[model samples]
Target: QCQGGYDEGAGGLLVSFYHLVKLAALSDRCTAGVMPPGEAPEEVRIKVFLERDGDLTIPTLYGLFRGADWQERETFDMYGIQFAGHPHPKRLLMPEDWKGFPMRKDYVQPDFYEMQDAY
Candidate 1:
């Protein structure tokens, strides 16, 4: 998961998970996603953005389960993407008791939170 900057001056934060399958594939090195995670259901596509000197490349795979089913739910909740074959495709961040996507860039941060100490 990654968080883009709120202001134009700050660079965005990029977060990635290193799965055991990936370690085995890369023989223990870091990697990045070349394509967005939503592209393929049967494969996990990752791009190796950085590696030891003389070793850098993009790679993709067709068989890898990186996490529990709920993990995909969290990704969906935060990023608003559907994992085609994931089980229990339900809201994981917003309460089942609430409404609408809260993490979207356009979501208005509630003024009450912003103004609480001003009064």
Candidate 2:
């Protein structure tokens, strides 16, 4: 199983989790003729919506799926979705001290970078 995809959902008010299982099928098909019986793995999707004006927090999948580490961080970075129990819960795309989630519906982009140095 792996974190196949993640993105801001519900018009930037939600965070979705798309999990993919048994990615080995691609390799198996390359070497084998056909998958026998019901050995094929099924993909699962789970969506969790949080209050737009409340704490946006959810349990981290990093413990079960190592592939979720970066994805979760990206969600936190871009959507301000907090991942509880994340080993390294830091920004993946934004600076450590950056303010506001740029992808959030209520976010207002600043006219200038606060941390930018004068030329």
Candidate 3:
């Protein structure tokens, strides 16, 4: 469970994962949202895991932060990040049934590799 979920939506780092927090049913992780007194909504970012856990599943904050709906969807589409209670856990930028998460650090595109070799 998060230590706090009251500051708009999420907060700081643990193990150096500023916003990539992953939670287990039996694990404890915290998440929150903050900004300067007058920051724009676009400045808000939802932190997930520290990139430590092997499993990347987490609960969605769409209920508390409506803005998260689209951002979560996009993250899911590109990074394979799963939000457990998301209202619509659909792909925003990729076709439905797309293979693999492209934004994850480990992802490797065949075309990219070929292009790199050509260069």
Q: TM-score of every model? A: 0.39, 0.72, 0.50
List model 1 lDDT by residue over 10-92, tens digit each.
13222223233333434323247343444422324332222212232222221244344555556446534445655476887
Residue by residue across 1-119, what tens digits does model 3's lDDT show? Answer: 12111111122211211233333311322224433454333222344443423555677777765767777777667666667998898898876756776655555665532222333
For every candidate in turn, the CA RMSD to the true structure comes to 14.8, 4.3, 13.4
Kindly provide the TM-score of model 3 when superposed on the true structure, using C-alpha atoms.
Answer: 0.50
Clashing pairs in 2: none
| Candidate 2 lDDT trough over 10 residues, lowest sum | 2-11
Q: Model 2, range 28-117, lDDT digits (tens) per residue?
A: 654465666766655666777666667888888887888898988888887778889999999989988788877776678888877766
lDDT of 1: 0.38
Estimate every model's Cα lDDT from 0 to 1: 0.38, 0.72, 0.51
**Model 1 residue 72 distance off true place after TM-score fit, in angstroms:** 1.8
The residue pairs found clashing in candidate 1 are 34-47
- Candidate 1 worst ten-residue window by lDDT: 1-10
Residue 115 in candidate 3, Cα distance off native in Å:
20
